[model samples]
Target: MIDQSLIDLWHGFGVAFQFHNLMWSFFGVLVGNLIGVLPGMGAMSAMSMLLPLTYVMNPVSAILMLAGIFYGSQYGGAIGAILLNLPCHPPHAVTCIDGYPLTKRGKGGTALGITMISSFFAASVGIIVMIFASPLLVQIAFKFGPAELFSIMLVGLIAGGTMSRGAPIKGVSMTVLGLILGMVGTDVNSGVQRFTFGFPDLADNLEIVALALGLFGVAEFLLNVNRMGAVGSNMKLGMKDMRPSRAELKTAFWPMVRGTLMGMLFGAMPGTGPTITTFLSYSVEKKISKNPRSFGTGNIAGVAAPEAASHSKTQVDFIPTMSLGIPGDPVMALILGALLIQGIQPGPQLITEHADIFWGLIASFWIGNILLIILNVPLIGVWVKMLRVPYKYLFPLAMVFICVGVFTTQNSLFRVGEVAVFGILGAILLLLKFPVSPILLGYVLGPMLEENFRRALLISDGSLQVFVATPISATFIGISCLLILLQLLFWLRNLMRARKVRESAGVPT
Candidate 1:
């Protein structure tokens, strides 16, 4: 099997290395890189816009190009996250936690450099995993049902609840608020509107693009308007200044490795996309760090781990899609639709039947990663220079991009207005000393949690024991409990410490 796979992969290179296919790959990554730097534009929008062009192209070249755009956007997303605090991609929201802090510290270039390195490293590992272990991983992925999914997502929410830089109560409160906001749309099971009041637009729930851009991008703009400062304005943009020091590199290396492993694992599982892995990766890094307080203060590991996880998970997301005829996320569904348009079916037999398409796509992954590294590494200075643009000029331009991006998501002016509303809300949260990242987390996970939880209950006729009936779900439940317990214990310890200090100073507790 291994030898056969090798021979087929070599033949795939023969197909992917063709002149036309190479051009397609280059064009896709180039365009994707550019789109990624823009606020609100993501790989899905870019690919959807270009999906029509694939109808006239060969299957091999079409998939290669789309695949390139997908991963290439992953590479470019860190730039906006690091340099401008705009999460051009959902996963990049985690990057903003540390990436923007690094930018404020004049290490934006170093953050971008580390981003590229981690991206390539994680993509390489993910490609290898796709090549050799996809079948086994697909089988494992099939074992997870609604009960298992709900339990694991519960774990994610519990862990991710502490993703703020402030007090735990505030973080948890923001997360709960996000969950409530996530419930804005019509109920999926009952078809009853929950929070729309009287608006038709709320029936589909709030757009993730609008929510993310509003909370992070527009809010930052509002808070900083007329403050008269460009990010990293005083930093030197020399090549040496952009490069990470040896110490920084060492600090980031292990996090990249760990994040890649997590990405590969979660990416192979259907329904668990890059967003969960990125947040979980960031949470794990914080949990295990010796200086956890430094996490939101420009920790390189915080940036490296989540970026690596997001990239690797993106690359490995193809496993369940190609092997089980399952689309892990909406973007993968689009790719699957493209394959269907080509009169191709994805399943276990796909590798044996469509060897060229399978292997060529794999080979293109390598080519695409190399192309991204070549295209973006030298452009670190160029991206960082956006910071040098006058704040008055830059914020308005960014707001335009954010508005356009949100509007394009549904061709709705209502979505644009939603951005302004959320922006105002975000500014208020910022003033209240609340963290915004957890809100995104709660919004993303809340619906899924509700859906899966309901599905599990329905399956078990309302018996909650179904949650722990399986080993996988049971294990996750255990982890969630342990996490909650640990959090409570830590809170108690901090309260006692505060009391001791107050007593010593003869002040009120």
Candidate 2:
């Protein structure tokens, strides 16, 4: 089986390396990278905008380019996070925790180097997993029904509650707020208008692009506009500084491996895209680190882990979408739509029937990652140079980009207005020491949670026992309960320890 797979893969290389196909792949990644660097723009929007072009192109090359764009944008998102502290994509948002601090300390180049290395390593692993394990992974994914998916999302939300830099309660509060915001728009089940508040523009849910850009990009600009002059003026990086030292590489290596494992685990599961995987990777690193306090203080592992997870998840996300005709996220959904337009059906037979599209795409993953490395690595100096622009000029230009990008998502001015409102809310969260990351996580998973739970109830005729009847659903619920219990124990330990400290200092309780 392995031998035949290798032969087919070699043939796939032939198809992918054809001049026109290669150029399309290059153009896709090039555009994707640019979109990733800009705030408010998302891979879904870029793919959506270019989706029409696929109608006139070869189906094989069309998918190759679109797939390239999807993952290429992921690579570009880290650049914005590392340099400007703007998480152009939610998955890379965790990178800003350490990446921007590295920039402040004149280590932006080293951070970018680590990000590139981790990304390449993780992508390679994910591609290999996709090649060998697609059949088995698809089986596991099939076991997940609405109940199982809902339970797992519950676990994700609980885990997300731990993502904040300040008090866990603050993180939980922000996550709940995100859930509330996610409720804006019409409910799918009843077709009733929700938090839309009589606005026709919000008949659909709030655009995630607007929410993410507002919270991270516009909010950062608002809070820092006064201090922008001194922010990057002292940043000095050269080619020499871009290379990671032995110690830094050593620190990042294990985290990269751990993160890749996490990505591979979650990537094959539909609806759990790179964003949750990245957050989970960051949380795991913080939990296992010898000094967790150093996580937000430019720890190399903090950057390496999440970037690796995001890229790995991005690569493996192709598994279910292509193999089982189930998209892992909205971006994959768009790609699936493109395939349908080409009169191709995706399923188990796709490999035997559409061999060229499947294998050629696998081969293009190698080419696209190589192209991204070439574009991002040698150009680190150029990316870092953007920071040197005076704050007076940069912030306004970024806002313009933000507005334009948000508007492009659906061509609605109302979405741009949504960005402004979230920007003010984000600034308030920052001032109050609330973690904004969880809010995005909650928003991403909230609707999924609601849909799956209601679907499960409907399927079981309002019986709650269906949630635990399946092994997968029950296992996830067990994990969620364990997480909550552990959190309670941790809080108890802290409260008791605080009393001891007070007693030692002879202070009143």
Candidate 3:
């Protein structure tokens, strides 16, 4: 299989570098980055909006363009999150927890450099895995029944619950709150309207862009309104500022490796996307760190891990999308539609039947990634120059962009209003010392988690044992339990130490 893939890849490089195809890849990557930079603009939106233009091209060129749009956007999303404390995409929300803080410390260029390096490394790892292990990953994804999927999501939620610095319960409660808010849309099973109090727009569920922007962007806007001068005060854009130190590079290496592996796994799965993988990466980095408390602060590892994971996941998304012909989400659905329109069938025989198309797309990944590296590095200076602009003037421009971006999501004023509401909610949570990110994780994962959980139960005739019935599911469940146990032990040890200190001090015991 490996030998055959090598032959196919060589042939693919031939087809992908055809002048027109190569140009499209560059164009796609450039457009993708632009889409990512704009708040609320996703690759799905960009592709859908631009897909009409692709209809005139041959199928392979179209696929290459769309594929570039899909993953290349991730490269730019980190820039917004790290530079402006605005997460243009949900996966980028995790980047903000540390990436933004690094920017605040005049390390924005270094952080961006790290994000680019980590993203490229992880994406290369993912692409290599796809080349070598696409078949294996597709099989693994099939093994994940709804029960396994539910178990994995549970692990993510549990890990996210413990992600905050001082307050696990606060994180957990925010997660629950997010889950509850996630339930606001109509229940898919019963078609019953939920939490949407006579407003028709709620039936489709909360927009992730609105929720994320509200929490990170608008909430920060409100909190820092008084301290406007402090925002981006440290954005010094020297050549040296853009490069990571030896110590920082060393710290980032392992997390990037771990995140790349995690991203590869999640990316290959149909239902589990970049958002979950990035969230899990953040948690894993925090867990493995000697000083976990430094995570929410400006830890370079935090930036490295999740950025690697998100970009890696984006690259790996190609596996299931191309191999299984399964569109894990709406973005891939469009690609699948493009395939059908091109009169190509998607199945296990995809690579064998359409070697040119498959191989060409793979080759485009390599080219697109190269293009992105060339495209983004110079932009670092431009983004840094923007930082020289004062926050007071900058934020209003951000607000206009946010409003325009959200409004474009569904062409509704209602969505823009939703951002304001969530902004207020996020502000309240922030002011009260609750970590708002777990809520976004819950909100992002909740609906999918509930759907899979219900589907798993339904498959087992409502038997709860189904979750642990399979070895795969059981292993995931065990991992989740182990993580919880570790957290419990940590908490208990802290409790005991605190009690001893209080007793010795003669305070109320």
* Best by the TM-score measure: 1
Candidate 2 residue-wise lDDT, 7-77, digit = tens: 98899999999999999999999999988887667687789899999999999999999998998998889
lDDT tens readout by residue for model 1, 333-424: 98999999999999989988998899999999999889888887677678878999877999889988888888887899999999999999
Candidate 2 lDDT (Cα, 0 to 1)? 0.88
Candidate 3, 1-509: lDDT as tens digits: 88988998899999999999998888889999988887667776788788888768888989998888877788878888988888888889999999988888778888998998898898888878878988888988888889999999999999998897777888899889989989998899999999999999999988888999999999988887766564565567665677888998999999998988888888878967678888999998898888999998899999999998887887788788877877766777888898888889888899889998988988888889889988877777777777676668877888888898888878899999999999999899888888999999899789989999999989999999998899988998999999989878988999999999999999998
lDDT of each: 0.89, 0.88, 0.86
Q: Each prediction's TM-score against the native?
A: 0.98, 0.96, 0.97
Candidate 1 error regions (>4 Å)? none
The per-prediction CA RMSD against the true structure, in angstroms, equals 1.2, 1.6, 1.6
Q: In candidate 2, which residue ranges exceed 4 Å CA deviation?
A: 228-230
State how far residue 280 of model 2 sits from its true place (Å). 1.9
For model 1, state the Cα shift of residue 246 in Å.
1.6
Error of 2 at 392 (Å): 0.6
